[model samples]
Target: MNVNHSNITITESACKIADEICLPDTYLPRVVVIGGGFAGLALVEKLKHKEVQVVLIDKNNFHQFQPLFYQVATSALEPDSIVFPFRKQINGYKNVLFRLAEVEEIQPSTNTIITNKGNVHFDYLVLATGTTTNFFGMDSVESHSLGMKDIRDSLNIRHMMLQNLEQAAITCDDKERDALTNFVIVGGGPAGVEMAGALAEFCKYILPKDYPEYPSSIMNIYLIEAVGELLGAMSDKASSKTLKYLKDLKVKVLFNESVSDYDGSLVTTKSGKTILAKNLIWTAGVKGQFPKGIDEKHVVRGNRLKTNFFLMVEGYKNIFAIGDIAALISKDTPKGHPQVAQAAIQQGKWLGNSLLKIIKDKPVKPFEYKDKGSLATVGKRKAVADLGKFKFAGYFAWLLWSIVHLLSISGFRNRLMVGFNWAVSYFTYEKSNRLIIRNFKPKSLVNETEE
Candidate 1:
């Protein structure tokens, strides 16, 4: 298969570049993956010893640990702790090569994949581009809100948060100070809940120590969700426990309250109540970031491509979609599996084993999702957990969540550092490194877009 990277002059250069990069190739049975997120990282790591030539391409070079992204946003952890360099992570693997480029398209018809850098031929393709925050096509939310999907977004949060606090410190005006101190987090997902809790802690426990001039009592954190409860995926017990914990942490929980629109200064809820603030964090819906060439009809709910039992695209054999991008079109998971790291890791490992079996002409085992459990932390000594039959909440649950995350981190050094930070924070109730490294403006889209 031959591919060309060119498009009509009417399209922008980036769009054209993406178009050209989507072509297929005819050479070796190359395994090309898009996106360097959890799913792609899992795939590359699992396929490290495979005989096939594997090329993993992503716009960014690091794989982000999304679970702790909220901590980074709220100054609990550093960016390095949550993100590992992709090349460094896969350096020991001989077959994998990491490329830093945006995949513009996927032209599976020609078996060639086009990227910003050039074209790559693939025998098997995995679209693990993952998902992006979906503001439900709301233009105001899309343009004026902040997203915490990756490292860059976390840094932006850190920057904006610090800047806001500093600006609020100097102001004696009550309205301006209230607006600056007020934080409206859109979405009641784990990210939203976690962020709200962390920010609340900052205001109640941490920020009081840092900014002694301004009263922490004026600082307010609002967690708005269109749904009736938080942690919707978890059990009702977990949800109830989490709600109580958040309330205890002083997070203003807004249930069944949807955000109508957001300007840079104010967040207007669907209930018509307006929240005046400079920061609006969006952790709402997320849609799969699939590569082109697949039929739009195959794209199901959540923007995920419908995949067969073996994780192969419904109408294609050589192509596969995994993680958040793959929608298992089964009655059991009509909408698809939750876009979590565990699901992606399982899919990647299954694909690796399945590929080996396929080369020897063996039957491929169907992918089965094992739901280990779910956990979300509220502030200090407060968390909720759902483990199949067993449920835990409060301090014990928080401890469990901490231990699990520490073990799940990608690198040994990161694990150590994060553990140390957690210990320090647990003891002090203050994040060690709250220094502002960069000044970020919400309008700085090119610089602040999450990787």
Candidate 2:
């Protein structure tokens, strides 16, 4: 295959090892980036058309807008509106190439990465594999409940909610109906808060029109947090306002409680409280995910790679880590940087700009992270923002959240779709098509069936 860009043409040749992944022969330094998340993509953008040959490898073919995942889960937006294709993102960037493969291991000694497809050698390897849902050793909850880590998780939640509603309508037993209608969202972070708010909105508006057999009051929306507050990362005022917004929407907020076990229908809390609910969305926490091969000594809490000020993995020369997976341990940032998109983007851009200098043995300054503020929305027209000294919540904050997220999306078409959906929902409380395209089964049940 021949890939052309401007005056450059890359042609694949049979000049590599028989088991090696095919790539066009190039004398330039090969920089292989694993995981096409925010940081990886940003680095690729900076390295495009530069001296290095950039190769981006990811398990998925698209970049998902994670902040809007709650909207997708609650059927407020379609999946495609929030996801952009990787190939589309790198359309004209000739120096950058995207490969779809799950990296399994990294042989740092050989400067090579082994993927499910084949092995690929790199001059400099970047680990931006990001994070996965952290169940914290709870096998029951992990298998029974859904997580909000990926686009597929959102779809699964949607289908499960819809299917449960349908089942609730058909069941003659009141207890079974209640279990089917109740929703228990774990964690008090932005994802869980937004998800609870959206579910409350759905129970208010959509449920009445779509399923009129039972009253909207039949659906119970519950937000369970281990702490006494919501949006613990935000200001106290923001947390109070978010709680108020959720209360106004008739959501039951359970503070100072965490889930101990979930058996597909019953959610038992650590405080000995139990709630019957088939739909449980776990947004509690996330731990770093990367290919095996790094030394255990360099791995920190949350399974993140310990890095120096330059974002280079500790004790490694050519291997680096970025995004959520990189923990730059310092006295100021003892827990590393916040696992947010802005932090990841800044790290990527900084590394991208400084990488070439480092490669040439030139002096480069350490990475400095700038706090860009935080924003989280509850339901429609209700959000909280903390922009330095300016802390506020309400319609203006919601508008800012909408604008920021809409513009942050990768493709212009995706932005348009999301904006249009928001506009329509603003006027009429209508959501996108809630079509149950496939059957969603719990992980444990699926495993049992497969076995």
Candidate 3:
């Protein structure tokens, strides 16, 4: 028989069904949220005291603060500062249960989710699975290049970065060392820009001290973008200023060019130019990630799950899609809302309220996204922002960026730790921690990209 809340007696089979069988029966309608990302966490927070029985499941048990992932990669912040334990996050919620399991498929017809651990039935199913790195079928680039989508991805880049330098320091061969020192970054979104800037700062301040044997000139940083501009989603002010800031930092900005291919060593662009680098970071694009079973009709651009105005998956009564995974296509939002933390947080809270109305038999309101604005920080004391009408960059924007990011970080201790790290770096022109805690070996992009 299939496993479910109805079967209170624990199973002794190999799949460890006992892990879930112990959950106290609340006798309330079960709501299964697949993902512990911003949206899923927000939803669970709202459903905490509500009548619903919330089952929050994710491959990882923590709620990772994604916006700061680049910081983690650059070693400006550690992993623990960004990853909050799901159990601790929902400490007091007696109605909610947390599970760490990889979902294999969603059998909507039977109202069941099949995971590696077991099968779970749900009265309402929420897919806040978020997005995965998109290579757009570039076999070579996907295989050779690095992507930073989560904590694991960030740590991979971090370890590889220091490891490459360490390897270069010991290697006698010139070509190999040059390849190690050369850094090529694809995509000029917040991730790429921030990474490029952080790398530039490292090259300027940290690398010189860390590796005095290698000349600062030997280390080169390149920020390549396909479009003629960077920060394509923001205003002209941000785009123009950031480009100038990057140029000031000595980061080679390649505009109107896209990486055509990479063969583990050489990076060739569409313009026929080539760069030799061992470290190739691809922050180019991302597509929605979800388990199998959803039909193509409900899938749209960027491989996102299509939902109605109310955030419900089209043609499914109890299934809802939200956050980066959800593409709420409308005349106003042709391509769907920008896949940012704001969109996810808003949609999650909105859906949570809507669900309360659902259980209370009240009117369900449609979701409408409010674009707060966008912010991207470049080198030290350099940043840009675009509010609805006001567009600003430089010192004040930089200050705002620091404050906003610190506040937005998950925990008080995290914010304090990050702040302390920043202060030390600024005052000393040095970073205290830069360790290859884990030896990073690149994973199979084919298997890793999808999850």
What's the TM-score of every candidate structure? 0.91, 0.97, 0.93
lDDT of 3 by residue, 254-307 (tens): 999999999878999998999989899999999999999988888998999989
Question: Residue 193 of model 1: what lDDT?
Answer: 90
State candidate 2's TM-score.
0.97
For model 2, residues 167-275, the per-residue Cα lDDT tens digits are: 9999999999999999999999999999998999999999999999999999999999998999999999999999999999999999999999999989999889999
Alpha-carbon lDDT of model 1: 0.82
Which regions of candidate 1 deviate over 4 angstroms? 1-28, 444-451
> What's each prediction's clash count?
14, 0, 0
Q: Which stretches of candidate 3 lie over 4 Å from their true place?
A: 1-22, 444-451
Q: Could you tell me which residue pairs clash in candidate 2?
A: none
Deviation from native of the Cα of residue 268 in model 3, angstroms = 0.8
Cα lDDT of model 1 by residue, 262-363, tens digit: 877788887889988878899988987765778887888878899899898888888888888889977898788888988998898888778767755789
User: In terms of lDDT, which candidate is strongest?
Assistant: 2
What C-alpha lDDT values do all the predictions have? 0.82, 0.93, 0.87
Say which candidate scores most in TM-score: 2
Ranking by TM-score: 2, 3, 1
As for lDDT, the candidate ahead, 2 or 3, is 2
